[model samples]
Target: MDAESQRVLEYLTEVEEGAEDVLATKQQIVDLDTKRNQNREALNALKTEMSDSGHPELRGYNLSPLSTEEIKAMNSILKR
Candidate 1:
């Protein structure tokens, strides 16, 4: 084969490799964007539901209604 043809084939191979890399990067970006949107929608829905549930009027910690003394006792054990 001619030298010019060999150079052209090498250039084309390089171009193809670059294109494949760009496509893979684009796919990864698209996947990440999709996941972020889904997570945002889920968080917004949860916030709306919590608001509708009147969480503000519940009048206690969401975790437990335990007294401060009980919490201190648990913390002491956890420190060990």
Candidate 2:
């Protein structure tokens, strides 16, 4: 085969690989989003349960109606 033809084939192969990589990354992003939603649902359920449990200690600590964002902020502060 001529050098130019080989170069074209190599370029096309690279393009295909790049497309495959993009597809894989997109799938990974979708999977992560699904996992995040599931985690959020579970966390929300736990918060409701904590509130319904009527635990005096939880009320005292004000953790029964916990907000996910608040927890994230607390973690950020602690990290600092």
Model 1 lDDT per residue over 2-52, tens place: 999999999999999999999999999999999999999999999999888
Q: Estimate the overall C-alpha local distance difference test score of candidate 2.
A: 0.93
RMSD of each: 9.2, 16.6
Clash number by candidate, in order: 0, 0
Kindly list the per-residue Cα lDDT of model 2 for residues 1-80, writing each as its tens digit.
99999999999999999999999999999999999999999999999998788767645654466599999999999999
* TM-score against native, each model: 0.67, 0.65
Q: Residue 69 error for model 1, in Å?
A: 28
Error of 1 at 66 (Å): 23
Estimate candidate 1's alpha-carbon lDDT, on a 0 to 1 scale: 0.94
